[model samples]
Target: MCRWLAYSGEPLRASAVLLDATHSLVAQSLDSPMGAETVNGDGFGVGWYPEGAVAGSIPAVFHSVEPAWNDENVRELSRSIESPLFFSHVRAAAGPPIQRTNCHPFRWENWLFMHNGFLAEFAKVKRDLTFAIDPSLYPHVTGTTDSEVLFHLAITHGLADDPVAALTAAVDQVERVGRDQGVLFPMQGTIAVTDGATIWALRYSSQGRSRTLFHSRDVPTIREMYPEAERLSQFGDHAQLVVSEPLNDLPGLFIEVPESTIAILDREGYHHEPFRSAA
Candidate 1:
């Protein structure tokens, strides 16, 4: 899979979250303690809103086939851009080639999406699922991985309606077909989808034991806990983060997203509810 973090709240430099944290996303590229692979250096990407872009406009994107630790562009861009919402991902190739098209922060208009797990035995179900894609979205399916396909499937099914239900249908479609082909544990992921403000992070898997997904506790709580932590002062009261793992080991810094749950984070604090998988 991969390691990624999605954040939204008061606008701040993207680098502050991705590069400056003690256990920053860049550091995770070299030493991601929580993922199955300690190092996710295959490729990386970052997407964030522009300072004056209209609501839901395409956020700027930077992707590299090089390891994140070795990429200068990411470092420069992260340090310069300020966004209220952004996504950064460092990948460990899970059966796909290292190419820009395969990199994450996949987009459809104002929405941005990233995935950090796999569809077990993808090769077995590739053709069937590809043909199943809606003709309207088939051309936009530029990547071969099941992750991108899942994103488009969600779009095709209706991301504009109910994102949770659309994603549920996408997973159900994958699992339903996988079962017919004798593929076990057909889906697993920690996905982030956002429209600048609200973020929908869903964590689930057929066999459970899905990859780790966590979100920071409210900024006020964290500030009170570590009054000396310099970074806490930069954030607003509603600031929050949804990450693949704890960015740092501060006590009560992050809360584990429960199994089969969709965590909704916006200007408000955070809310978790059991995900009703709909397919």
Candidate 2:
């Protein structure tokens, strides 16, 4: 398993959450209390839409096959860049080889996708799953990880038109294929996807117990709860975050997203709904 986070709201330096927090994504990479693996040092990646990006503009990505905590470039770049929406992920390479191409926040056109879970027995169903991708999109499948294939599968299933539906379909395909091959638990993990404007985060697993996930409570709500917490002043009323785990120990600061649920964040704020795959 890996760890990831998605941010959507006011423009802010990526480092604010990726490095500056008490349990920032970088910190989680070094020592994650809730992750299946404590150290996710295989590699890391960041994808962000520039602060003033025009509509339909694609996000930029920086990937490195280096432990995030040891990568000087991760700190430098994150501090310099401000984005209204972004994604950061640290990998633990369950079975795939560590390489730049295998990093998270995989991009296609204006959309970015990242996963914190895996498809069980991927090798058994890798061929079937890969072949199921549309030929036009299949060529872009440059990595061997199941995460990348899952992203493309979502695109093939209509991610651009309807992300929640597309993701459900993608999971269904993976489970159907895996079960056919005799894997009882075909899928397990949390996923986040964004198109520079809206973010959709999902927590699900074939066994009904997915990895942990949480979204920040609205900024105004947090400020009201802790009137003297000056740190909360930096955020605007609309600022929100969905992460693999809470960034800090501040009580009521984060709300755990329910299992088998999809959390959607946009200008309207977070909305969650039950998520189920046909399989």
Candidate 3:
């Protein structure tokens, strides 16, 4: 398992969510109360679109196998850079070796992706899933984790055009392959992806018990709900976050994304729709 967050709206220091929150991603990396694993020390990565960049520009990436809490580079970069959209992930490797190549927040073109779960009995279906990816995208998969494979799978199915539909199709294929190989409850996970503008997150499992996920309530609502909380003052009206768990314990600040749901967050705001497999 792993923990990750996606932010959209208002260009601000990445550290606002990655390092400065009450229970920030760095804090979660060390003591995650809601993640499947408490210590996600395997590796970490951050991907963010540069300010004022044109459409289709690939995000800047920083990856390290060091624990997020101990990584000075992560802290420095988070404080120095600001972007309207970005992703941060601290991984707990289920099987893949801990290495920069196996880090989360994988990128392709203008898109960034990360996952916090596994393909049950992946070895049984790895071949089927690997071969299913479109040949053109196959060569671009550089890591050996199911997460990276899933990203490419989504790309093969048209993630760049329709992220929700493509991810649904990708999950459907993984489950179908796992079932074919006799693995029960084949998929389990929460996923976050962005194209430097809009963010799409999913919480689902074949058995209907997905990992935890939540998105912040709108800034205006949060300010009114926690008027005395000083942290609320730091965020702009457009600030929004979708995470594997709540960044802070402040009541009503974050809304739990329903199981089997796909959440979408953009400049317009956030909404969720029921997720269904294409297969």
- Highest TM-score: give the candidate number: 2
Error of 1 at 26 (Å): 0.4
Across residues 181-276, which tens digit of lDDT does each residue of candidate 3 receive?
Answer: 999888999999988888999999999899999999999998888889887777889999999889887878889999999999888898889997
What's the residue-level lDDT of 45 in candidate 2?
Answer: 98
Worst 10 residues of 3 by lDDT: 270-279
**Candidate 2 lDDT trough over 10 residues, lowest sum:** 229-238
102 Cα displacement, candidate 3 (Å): 0.7
Q: Is 2 or 3 the stronger prediction by TM-score?
A: 2
Residue 122's lDDT within candidate 2 is 95
lDDT string, candidate 2, 78-182, tens digits: 999898899999999999999999999899999999999899999999999999999999889998999999999999999999999999999999999999999
Q: How many residue pairs clash in each candidate?
A: 0, 0, 0
lDDT of 1 by residue, 1-279 (tens): 799999887788888778888899999999988998999999999988876677758777888989999999888989898888889899999899999989998887788999999988999988888877789889888877788988988887788678888888888898988888999788898999987768999999998788899999888778889999886777888778999998886878999999899999877668887875544
In terms of lDDT, which candidate is strongest? 2
Please estimate how well model 1 matches the true structure, expressed as its whole-model Cα lDDT: 0.87
